[model samples]
Target: MTTSIAQPSQTKQPQHVDPAKKRPKVLIAGGGLGGLSLGMLLQQTDIPYEIFERATEPKALGSAIALSAATDALFKQCNIYDEFVSLGKKTLSLQVIANEQRRVDYKMDFSAQQQVLGAIGHVIARPALHDLLFRQIPKNRMHMGKKILSTDDQGDNGITVTFSDGTTASGDILIGADGAYSAVRQNLFKRLKAHNKLPAADDVPLPYSTVCLVGQTRPLDPAVFPHLLQDDCQFINTLGENKPWAQGTVCWSIIRFVEESKTSTDDKNGHSIVDQEWGPEAAEAMCNEVRHFPVVSGNEVNPLTLGDLIDYTPKDLISKVKLEEIVFETWFGGRTVLMGDARPLNPAGGVGCQNAMHDAIILANWINALPSDPTSKDIENAFRSYQDERLPWIQTASNSTRFYRTMASGGIVAGLLRFCAKHMPAWAKRKMLVVLGGNRPQCSFLPLVEDKGSVPPAFQPSLLATKPKTPATSV
Candidate 1:
């Protein structure tokens, strides 16, 4: 991990927000799941926040994501789980496939993703979850088109964020919930370089192959997803002839139908979701290249959304998951701390959103835990506690997941996937799931279930099962 200082902008220093206010003003950048979730969580608390989103509208980029049971606790706490129920499909089975052979069809959640094994979660469409969170958020709190151009943490008492449009807002604190390509994190990198505290150059290209496509479709003919709902998560892996394979090796894994466009009004006009929402034609292009499997997640959902329209015109661009750094050099420095993809930035292990949400959960709790009339030391203590409590597992999950993805995706390069898929016994797959999904060495911080496995006073599997994957440190 290498962190370098970019020249700081010749901008004015940040003005301070009144720290004595009962609800500290917080500025959140980026409006993805992390930003929205953070905002929703804070709303329940006394913390008032201003969420800044560069995009003019809310768009679901990428595809579906499986929220682990642990992360779902935070959602439930925010009181939006029921809203998600209407938008998401309840997955309940785990089935593994290699060519035509069914390797393991265990009862589990996230069964659709072969990479996951133990921790049961809901593999939901990004749009659905986004809508749920957006709906729950107080409409007045959102500033849709404001793009943050620069941020300055005064270090005295607050941070000030300036938008590209020349408007400025000051907050008692700034939470960098921005995505992987984060501007706030970039500013922190520059600040760290100014203070001379970043890591040295050690980043190199990681060789792996995982070209994924994101679209939506209905569940299988007899409702195959219901079977996965039976357990925690369901994962189906297809070990290709020349693809990668290992106990935890995951080369060809699919996320199934987890993303959707709630309204076509955005697309019909110029307004849209994320820049990545693909219509039918672009999805077809991806299928034409990625090789169409037996109605993988996207293929099925595309038809449902684009009915009677045989072909979709091109707009959204779909691409492979090719990257170099799984972890960034410095996530936070001084008064500015990075969270979400801007934090760990792991490509695999389904940790990105997890890490981001955990950032919110731990940070919000820490601040709220502080004395009502808190001091700078109180703020600093909260910051330190957030890092100390969350950093260890995040570090471990980042290294572990990166290593896991490297090995699984490297099966082709190292001549492992094909050999193991053909020779490895069925029992090996089950054991792999235990390690990959349950009791993962890197992410002990994330318990299989949240709340230390404490059953609520009203113990209901459906209520308990509605949880999504908890905060992933790797994200």
Candidate 2:
């Protein structure tokens, strides 16, 4: 069964409000996917917002990202669905194999995702997706090299964020969409800890059980790489003794999980652990370590290796990063809130980017409905509403991510999961797909996209709770 996308009959007209209108001014920390997406959503409303990034310029950093129908509605509402589909290749199945023996373990079918959930899953290079999101945002609103040093939530007076360059900016709301080692989060945690209001789990340094090295190769010739000739992506995973490599059409990630959490200040060799660092030196080290790993996608006669992919990838585009599994108990406080990697997750299941965009969608809904002159209580309530609607979904995604990670491991747990996955009934698989792709959150302020799946989407509270009272004007 296949579900067809119906073009929206009407498009929502972009809100053109006077710049001087006293609406809630949003200050976003980070210019990655989350921040840029939130900014794009906010652009549809009368809300004022600006994005700040620590990087001097955007680097094409990450490898591939998997997007499901969970965000297809939001993309259609934002008028970027067509372009997103064009840039991505639809993924039909995930084939997992034992790396050393080259034996097939199990294959998870996603061909029915379109029929059951509304849209097929897509796998695109992260840089291409990032560039697509970046193009939607205005140049004037996105500030580069503005590292957030600290935040001050001044009750009803509004919030203030001080940057590394000794400059300050004020806004009605502060969103920490920065990555795992977020300065905005560190600053907020400091103030919460001073009052003994921070959760013990949220106060400590982020823990990581795995390190992932991700990179995308330059476009390859279809003649040389026969897999590239396929119309749809064939997602593959090769599970080794301790290292698992998840392969996309032109991108890949080599993940090595440790037995225990490595959260120490320094490595065993006495060198400081820069977990968030994506510098090429660290990436190169990991690249060389996994260069000889076997790739299961290629034919036995022409066996491919990680070194082939690495050689095709530009040096500057590779990155080594940590994967944390904890879903922080506290998401928002006062006027400060967190989104994206600030509330980190292990990306074993490729749900991190999806959750980040979902967070932005929900947060933007609540922010759009805010009163122009909101009091502290009103601000707090809005922030709470954003978290209330987003937290449960984040926790669910985190749980699934962990389970998938375990399933890819070489332990007994992984063996059991593989057995179950191989024997999972077709009905069970479809049910799981429905559960996984059910939450298709859309902007309440924009014209809603018609649902095309057989199964209805999960209930979205933010859509009903924060919808604009007046019908959105259409172009």
lDDT of 2 by residue, 1-475 (tens): 1112333323233576765557888999999999988988998887878999999998888877888988898788888888788778888988887656656667888889888987888887788788888877778888999987678889889999998899999998899999887778877877888899998877666778888888888777655467776778767888777665657347888888777886636444222366545466788988888888877554556767888889988887788877776788888788888999988888887899999999999999888888767877888898888888888888889889888888877778888988899899999999889878989898998999999999999899989988768767999
Query: Which ten contiguous residues of candidate 2 have the minimum total lDDT?
Result: 1-10
TM-score of each: 0.65, 0.92
Q: Candidate 1: lDDT over CA atoms?
A: 0.50
Scored by lDDT, model 2 comes in at 0.81
User: Which numbered prediction scores highest in lDDT against the true structure?
Assistant: 2
Candidate 2: misplaced stretches above 4 Å?
1-13, 16-21, 101-103, 246-248, 264-279, 297-301, 470-475
Candidate 2, residue 224: the lDDT equals 49
